[model samples]
Target: MKILFLSLVKVNSLSDRGIYTDLLREFVSQGHHVTAVTPVERRDSNSAKIEVEKGFTNLHVRTLNIQKTNFIEKGLGMLLIGRQFLRAINSNLSGEKFDVILYSTPPITLYSTVRKLKHSMNSHTYLLLKDIFPQNAIDMKMMKKDGILHKYFKSIERKLYNISDHIGCMSPANVNFIKEYHKYVSTDKIHVNPNSIEPIIQTISSKDRELIRADYELPLDKSILVYGGNLGIPQGIDFLIEILENVKLENVHYLIVGSGSEYQKLKNWCDQNKSDHVTLLKFLPKEKYDKLLSSCDIGLILLNKNFLIPNFPSRLLSYLEMGLPVLSATDPNTDIGDILEYNKCGKKVLAGDVISFKTALNELLSSSSKYQEYSNNAKKLLLQDYDVVNSVQIIVDRVEQVKFNQNV
Candidate 1:
């Protein structure tokens, strides 16, 4: 099968370790031809180009910077990206007829390009629904409900959903949300296909851990709770700051590593407070970050209390990969906490609840036996629920079902 993958994520190489790259590599490994179309942001000063490797091809389309930019530029870039992608696809991949048109969301503006390709090639379309739009924007107070921009994007969202042959949601909650809110979308078309990765078996020796900690100047005696990912609005930066301000734990250290729109907010607080227990650093390279993560004892996840949409951050995989127990402070809508608690892998507290957050942290810290159990379970959860092989099978099974139906 020849697969066309449309995404906003920059895929410079298929060898990189990420959810998308891992999935694409699995598709190729399964004897499927994969062509991934992604953006090369204007900030990079790179022109559009295509690279064909062994069993995979990548088309890098030149576009305005859509990530790590101001709202005005991000919005304009998203709105214009569909047409830009379509033009590039036509110009370069005109002769290619895809068997499957697979794409993910963050930008719902790709409806035009998806529609065009699906019609042109008569391909089975699959939506890897990563982010719920317009509604998520409204939840963050980034856009007003019933406003012109909201309605416009909402329309695009619906069109995108309607055209997709199947929608793979991140969790059961996401499936329920889509079915409850969008009555027109059939339940049979939506299934839980989570953010998955090819697990890297990482084992750090005691000496290696100490070396990594010493190199980064991290305290060796303190129990480090690291939060590694985007420091954005969705993370509810205010609540995170409140936790830092109020927490009185002497033995527990907080290490925050990531860059986003709200990074300055975190940096400002860190500078003003000058707390010895807290360490704030900019985003590090993946190889370096993984080593740093392995040195930590716990992984922290923070989400805004206002979100009505259930967001399952891919960062959870990183924590699980390192066999670190997770402490997620997120909205009640997401089931990430439920998964953790059920698997005995981690604890979850409702976002903005400082007391509960502190209590959960203490529970994990106080019990050495419980912490070890959670650490063991974390790796189990990753292998059982979030391996890339499961995600590949889900997608391939769906495509096979479609082929059988058409032939019948």
Candidate 2:
């Protein structure tokens, strides 16, 4: 089968270790030809081009400054990305016949393109529902509810949902959100397809770990609680700062490593206050970050308290891959905490509750036996629930079923 993958994230090589890239590699290993289309947004460049890298074709469409930009610029870039992507696909892969058209969420502007592909080739369209849209924006107060922009994007989101032949949600809560609220969507179309990854083998001797800690200036004896992902509005930066300010401990140190709109806010606060317990760094390369992660004692997950949508953060997979226990502070709506608790892998606290957050940290710091148990559980949960090979098989089975029904 020939598969066409669409996403905002760049996946130039199968060797890339991430949620989508790993799945694309799995598709290839299963004897399918995969071609991915992703954007190459260079602020100074004013051209769109196609390139082939590492045995896959990529359409790098140049667009306005989209990611990690001001709201106005990001919104404008998102509005135009769909049409630009469609143009690139039509021009570059005119003769291609894709058996399966797989795309993920973020810029829900690709409904028209999916519709065109389905009409042109009779392809099976699948939505890897990663991020739910306009509602999440509204939850962050980035857009007003029922406002012109919100309504427009909401309409587009509906069209995208309708275009999908199968919609794979990030969790059971996410699946329920669509089934209960969006009455137009058929129940049979939704499936629980949680975030999955291809686990990597990372070995670091005690000497190597000590050297890595020394190089990064991380404390050798302190228990490091690391939060390594997007430092954006969705993370509820104010709440995170409040927790940091309130939780002053001698043995517990916080290390935040990522870049986003909220990064400057947290960094500026840390600098001005001379926060001793917190260390904030900008994004690092994947290799360095993974090593840094392995050295950490625990993983941290954050979500806005106001979110109506249930977000299952992909960073959990990284923590699990390293056998590090998780400590998540999220809204009640998200079931990330539920999963962690059920698997005995970690503890979860409601976001914005500084006292609960502090207590959870203290609990982890207080008991080594408990921490060791959680660490073991984290790795067990990863193998049981999040392996990419299992997710790939689910997707392949869905495609096969769709093909059988079509023939019948």
Candidate 3:
């Protein structure tokens, strides 16, 4: 099968711990051709856009002049990216046919490019619905329901949904929310395609882990709780600062390993609050991240309470694969909370619940036996369910099934 991926993020290597890479590798491994269409520069990258390729899947980075200095500029950039991508496809891929076109969303305004590519390449489109759009904006009070921006966003969102052959959501909660909003979309067509974690990097040994930590100035003596990947809108700086002020566990240090648009804001907040237990670091290379996560004691997830959407961050899966229990500080009704509770994979507290968050940490800190149990469960569940091999198989099988059904 020849698959074309339309993603907002651009990376050189296709083995990174995200949806774009996860699925790309899966297709390539199954002897399929996969080409990802991504931005000139990663919108999420705080440092610089790095091109990477490791096993089979190769990334095709598309350049775009994203004038996203401000909100209006950002909106216009998104519009142009989707608008311009269509032109790129029409000219470059008109002769090349694709078996499937996987389009991810958040900007939720890629109808022109996706629709054009769908017909131009004569491909079946799959909407990998990661975030709920205009509704998420409304939840954050960034936009209003009946406002002009809301209407415009909703318009593009509907067009994207209307044209797609399948809508794959990360969580059942999101599937439900999307259905509630868009009754026209058939529930049968909604697939739960989760954010999967690839296996841990096996090349790094215990000695290698020790040396890497020493190089990074990581405290190997104390237990390190890593909060890796993304430090932006969903995980607010205010909520994280409150956690630092509230949770005062002993012999445990918090290592936040990633940089985002809000990294400086969080850094300033840490300095102002005089947070001694917490340390912030920029995004590490994939190899280093694998080494660090393989050695970490605990992993943390932090999100604002206002986020009603079920956003299961891909980082959690990485934490689990390392056999580390999660300290999932997220919303009350998110997929993360449910997974942690059901799988017995560590503690979960509603976001902004400083008291509960502190208490949960205290419980895990005080009881070594309980911590071990949760950690073991996390590793067990990671092996059983969240493994990328299993997820990829499901995706491949399902795509074939969808194809068969379409034929029938």
RMSD (CA, Å), each prediction: 0.9, 1.7, 3.6
Q: TM per model?
A: 0.99, 0.96, 0.88
lDDT of 2 at 380: 86
Model 3 lDDT per residue over 233-338, tens place: 7786678877777676767788888877788888887788776688888888866777777777788898878887777777777777777778888876577778
lDDT, residue 326, model 1: 98
Instruction: Give the range where candidate 3 is weakest over 10 consecutive residues by summed lDDT.
Output: 47-56
Which candidate should be chosen as best, given lDDT against the real structure?
A: 1
Predicted candidate 1 versus true structure: per-residue lDDT over 245-275, tens digit per residue: 9986988999999999899999999999898
For model 3 the TM-score comes to 0.88
Tens-digit lDDT track of model 2 for 1-408: 888988888765678889999888887777778888887776745466676655466677777788767778887888788788878888889988988899999879888888988889989899999989988989989889999989998899999999898999999999999998788998888999889998874666889878888888889989999999999889988988998888888998899999988898998899899977888989998878998988899899999999999999999999999988888999999999999989988889999998888888888767889888888889889988899988888788998997788799
At residue 10, give the lDDT of candidate 2. 71
When 2 and 3 are scored with lDDT, the better candidate is 2
RMSD of 2: 1.7
True-vs-predicted CA distance for residue 89, candidate 1, Å: 1.1
Count of backbone collisions within predicted model 2: 0
Instruction: Estimate every model's Cα lDDT from 0 to 1.
Output: 0.94, 0.87, 0.74
Candidate 1 minimal-lDDT segment of 10 residues: 67-76
TM-score of 1: 0.99
